[model samples]
Target: MKNLLYFFLLTFTVVHAQDKPNILWITIEDTSPQFIGCYGNKDASTPVIDKLAEQGIRFTNAFSTGTVCSPSRSTIITGVPTFKMGTGNHRSNYPIPDFIHGFPDYLQQQGYYTSNNVKTDYNIANEKDFIKEAWNESSRTASWRGRSKEQPFFSVFNFAESHQSRTMSMSFDWYVKNVWNYLPEDDKIADDAFEMPPFYNDTPEMRKQFARVYNSIKLTDNRIGELLEKLDKDGLRDNTIIFFYADHGEGMPRGKTNGINLGYRVPFIVWFPEKYKHLSPWGEAGSVTDELISFEDLAPTMISLAGGKVPDYLNGRILIGENRSQPKDYLLLSSDRADNGPDLVRTITDGRFVYSRNFMPFMPEMRYIRYIEIADITKHMRSDFKLKKLNTLQEKIFKTRPHEVLYDVENDIWETNNLVYNSEYNAILKKMRNQLDTKVLQARDILFAPEYEIGLISKNQTPYLYRLDDAKYPFQDIYNVASLSGLKSKKTAKEQIKLLKSKNEIVRYWAAVGLMSQNKTTLESFKNKLMVALHDKYPPVAITVAAIVHENFKTEESTQLLKQYCKSDNMDLALMTINYLLYVDDKAPFIETIKKVHDMPNRNYNVKAGCMDFLGILNIVENTSKTEN
Candidate 1:
């Protein structure tokens, strides 16, 4: 018995030793490389990140698959391209493949206790089972300590301070009052020195916007430093392999959570004190590697470092030690939906050259009002185009793009100059086009197929627009939807209704969506129209109608209709019905319904969570009501 115990102990020790490097992935929300001192941003003071870069490796040319949080994070965790993961668009509703496991999940399988700091917006079918524990920043440290000591740990900490709506009014004012005074007279003050991107005009308001952004980044840096200090206090610093990165690009005019290079390109730094000296296959400490890397590579790299086998389904390569090869021959970046501009654009980049394929080429540059509103410089430029205060070179970059574009990054760093028209670049452009075509085909992009479908169904016998050619005004309906959302007066209701009759299903859907926000009188005519839409072939339209009805009306007829639909053979419609029922009366029945659905063995966790969350919300509401009563 003693000898057998010794042998088992020896085996456990060997396995434990192999997995000593605990991964601590620190992700910042909506941040860009420009804020980090390690990335050569002298204006920003990011000592914590700078120290980490010095200890390990800082990747200079890392790009995210998508510019937004959901798609980028989904690609990172799945070790697959956004398109392959069915998360090519924002807020994806499709089920996540079982084979696609998050790095933390993989680590847990290897006996590591994995935890996350509250944010898990991977846009997966179900998000509950992804992490072992999730807590707000305040409780994250305590939660980490509460984990079992026998197992090594993997923890992801996300800092949300830098997120848009940078609510640091006091900090912003301080920076303006103090930091601005320290700079030399020639040094560009935020009010004078700030230059807008190609899409915007140079204006003082734009400069102030830049200043506010800088202050937000500073606050993020401070929080990151605090988290690092906690790791040290807990004596986990030496053993932890810290990886720091932003979810996507900075949220600004052209960069605001879009698929553009400025939006997707991010900073990536990895530091492991235990293996610091030995893991320099790429280069020395603080050495910036120009090798193009993407978020997809992160999961495989983490898994490989944890002494685990890389699953064959993962498309990314491990980027540590001997595996430091040149980046993918051509990296693909894509965007689908955000705000009011439902545009689709894809780009192929080979470090030196970038080729963009715009599916919606006719969409105006400033299709979304939010983009224009926040873009102080663009607003100014559009207000007075006659002034020509904006440079012509910048104007060309801001103007509507063509179906195809080629940029030599070596010469045009800002991607301002298009070399596609040049005869000399024709061969390069052709090669890139072929590569993109082949990649899309290989990836099984739905759009590339002969019978490409837009995943919409409507019974109104409307003309369904299908085409191989790129359409420019695909986002006009989206813009109209925005107008409806912002409408305050009854006078605009008729105009809003007119916009809802657009040929695009997305437009009509948004119009119906906008009606839900109005008063009873405004929605009276629209409600009957919406009820008629419940029979619309499109599941989303039906689901939206059901939701609106359930929220506004608690009639027995409506409840019966919802309950009947909830039992439908079509799981999509059924799910939508259950969601609507949750918004209506009788908490007990709704909770029971959710529990019954959740108890099913084969139902997806997301489906379960969708039901369970309603119960959770009811519990909260009940507690609040009890206190008040």
Candidate 2:
């Protein structure tokens, strides 16, 4: 019996060694495949990436859940949608409980050495809440080299030389009035940018800036080459599964933080080394596949490669290894509050068509984040806007967005054309709308709340009440209110009033949204109730109350009432205060209140950045007036 047991243990160890492959993710930040030579950009100096593609399988249709780092990383970490995790806002960190561990924890349980060479900005409230057991080591010095020889590893390394911030000269780059690429002081870029996209004017400066970005890509590619060289020298190359991908798209104007293809589409290459080729679902070298994959899919793929079962809770699928599945028919995209203000956006794409729903259609897409304004691209875009050099198509992004947008992803990959208005595409529009609505409803997206409420819940470690079915605004309830708000019928005024008086704060907030949709005269009847709602505990409820005050009264008293929340210790409240105050009046008195917020310490980064930008724009306006005089 002892001999038999020993034989079984030896067999188990040998089989385990063969089945598990070391997964190494060489994560390059703030770049897209379009910027790489392998992805058809002749201007890019990306020999390493091109070589990786030659050795691996290249995926042309991979999408990221977000355009920015935090929200996208949150989804990647949790293997869940950003909204579902309640970490939807960029620069905000929401905690994950001990019991609910990330995929790395599962890998660690199976004795896999998990290491991350720094970059743990997972948008969690308590980053320490990260399960320590999930990683053998996670630091700048952490590497699979330190792991025991018998143990396979799952390691992630981030190269940020290509990040937008690195290309700039100063830490406060955005605060400067004029911004340009500070690296490679003497830029050697000629007047060319592959094919300048329609939005950009073909100018020497623009071409130079584009070339500077290519230079950064080249630097990042060389870094990748060095890392791969180290792997080959260690003689672990054949036993490893290598993945090269960007955090998101290139961080530039109309890309990066935006929820468009220019922002979300990323380069993905999976190298199943010759020794492990049979383990790969693709089972081939140097192939191109059109797979609709998202960052969420990475967690499950890693889990499967570690010889572990993918959990049902994870929305991702095993893209390779055992239990491998076909590519997704569609992938979802979501972006919310990239900076200080709110830009509630959700999208669904099936490789051919892309559809987006902008819940806050009243808000312009180019809200000019104070920090991001440091880029020269922003200065150029805004200058074009002021000079009226931009055509109607160019101005659309700066203006209030359409509630819904439909684009032919194949014909218009840049998403310039909105096919929603075309009667011929009505059926297609309906189908896309239904697909998006179903996704939102199915996820019970907590973004149904106002920005303040979303911000509030996101800041607090444990979620307020956002569960699949347990939230204050369940999927169907919010869906019903959403449908009703569109009608804006005077006949439903009484029903809305009842909702405003409901016990649930979410209900009252939606009720206010419905009331605000109506014409001022039609909504006048609720003046007293809105005033009472001003004293509501929740910021979302109070925001609606303030909106009503601005619409109905627009008085000094209302501004003062909103100002009370400026020092309320929450950036969201302060920014919302500024938003309301600015909407009502942008005079000296209101501007003072905004400055007061700028003066506050420990304020959220986005809010502080936003205030600075707003002040800068105001300064520009004031200077222009003086010049004219």
Candidate 3:
């Protein structure tokens, strides 16, 4: 009798799982809404995504948490913003909290076979140290059809056909042999087909590069259609909820790592099958909504649909199906410290208006980050900046930017005009400024924390928690001092100098960076204090002092101090030290210091991926290096 009872319970469990709906995510890399047909661009050929838009609700305002790949992908799977969870930096291989695995773990507990048909790069390292989870399987061979007949499933398909590396095929040889050579030569767009943005020169060669990007998009569209066709043939279309979107923005010159709309804005479409239309929040077919969505929301909405608990720790809220609810009025976006160097920027968008706050307003030379320099278009931009080929509006890229910028994105699409100085929009700009401040304080954003120490913060629950337990640097003071450049008072410099004596190493480091940028003339007045800072226990602080002493005093001690940092044992610190020397002169005496790391067999992925891509321009300038872009 007990054996019969067990059999009956098993049958009920299988039937219960089959009754739930299936969720499918089809994600592509490095694309914006501007490349798609339904999102205002009719020139590009994306019939599959356009058809999907027509069948479901299309979102006009959607964004990702971070502008870069690893950080943004990390937020997508965990339903938590990397900034709050202490995984904000790119590809650091940081350890996450014990309670946090991913939304798929919740679905698995509820009886769903979750599979990712190929890429799973969420930045957080997997427990086994191979990659992220491998439920059933996570490759091209993994499929929903392979599951039991009565078991519902959740599947994710990631397409990399339109990644930035693929777009560089026309000029970059690495892209040509690996990505472009595989595609049909005949499947190309017309030369000079689209209007180039203000950031790029309007030349025939520039237009040709843009054409290659459109062709890659075409390949991704074809792939999406094939996958959808398979769902129809298997008779699972009516039982599935299909979502199509991009991971982040395209990597076309200035678009990739920057915090502009071209970086974070993505095309998002959701196709609710006719039978499952009742479960959707907006059941109207072919309808469009102006609601804003973030990458962090995907996991929570999917977990809620699987009849599992949504963790309170998630930064995102449900945006689709029955559990959908609005959390805040505006969507926040940030980008920090990519492979190029240490850069910090934040943006707040309320669907139409955009307000940007640049904390590091003095470092305008970052416009030539290594990955961007590899593009043929940027070469034209740099030569134009020197030759006066560009207009005053186009020349803004070369110089330091103002503290704040405001844009009415609807009218000024390219964001060419700055209205922050304009009196008419002062009221709107103030409200937007206050809105951003409220969000930043509420989240306790660790924008000023040292990037090298972020990995350790992740293991101790989070940066915020560690600060609370230890009370180092008085967290809020660092953000205030980092933004001290905007103030004209001499007292601000005094405040930073006082903080230089702090017991905390990270606080002392940023204080030195702030003191130099705020007022270098005042630095000589505190030579005794500045000399003490030159020998800081932290390399980041000592490195900045090296730049200050060399740039201001030009002493022998500064050169020796600079050489010591160039050979730092930590790879991240070593590369940053090299970048600091290049910021002043075309070449440094310690170029061989970084070259030795390139020779080491035990180097980390961060050093391997960078290899002074930023500093390699010296060799290119000398016409000596033969490395790939």
Alpha carbon lDDT of each predicted model? 0.60, 0.72, 0.73
**TM-score per candidate:** 0.65, 0.87, 0.90
Highest TM-score model number: 3
Model 2 segments more than 4 A misplaced: 1-15, 129-131, 167-188, 191-193, 450-461, 469-471, 482-503, 511-537, 548-553, 579-588, 624-629
Span of 10 residues, lowest total lDDT, candidate 1: 456-465
The residue pairs in collision within model 2 are 93-123, 93-124, 93-125, 94-123, 94-124, 94-125, 174-374
> Could you list the CA RMSD of all candidates, in the order they appear?
13.8, 4.3, 3.6
In model 1, the Cα lDDT at residue 85 comes to 48
Candidate 2 lDDT tens digits, 407-447: 88678766789898899999988987888878787777776
Off by over 4 Å in 3: 1-11, 127-134, 169-187, 365-369, 386-388, 456-464, 467-473, 485-491, 519-528, 586-605, 608-611, 620-629
| Model 2 steric clash total | 7
Candidate 3 residue-wise lDDT, 1-629, digit = tens: 99999777766766788878888899998888888889888688888999999999899888878877888888887877776656667665666666676778788767787887877767765534423453656777878876777788899998888987777524656555645566566655676666677766677767767766787888888889899999899888999999999888876865677776777788999989877788767658899978888887888888888888888777587876567777557888887766645667778888788887776665563354555666666665665565667777778866766767788877887777778989999998988888877776667676457766665565555554554443653666666666664453468778877888878777777777766565457666776777778888777888877777776676678777876765566776765665566555424555675577556676665554345553455645544223211
* Candidate 1 global CA lDDT score: 0.60
RMSD of 2: 4.3
Candidate 3 clashes between residue pairs 3 or more apart in a chain or in different chains = none
Instruction: Sort the predicted structures by lDDT, highest score first.
Output: 3, 2, 1
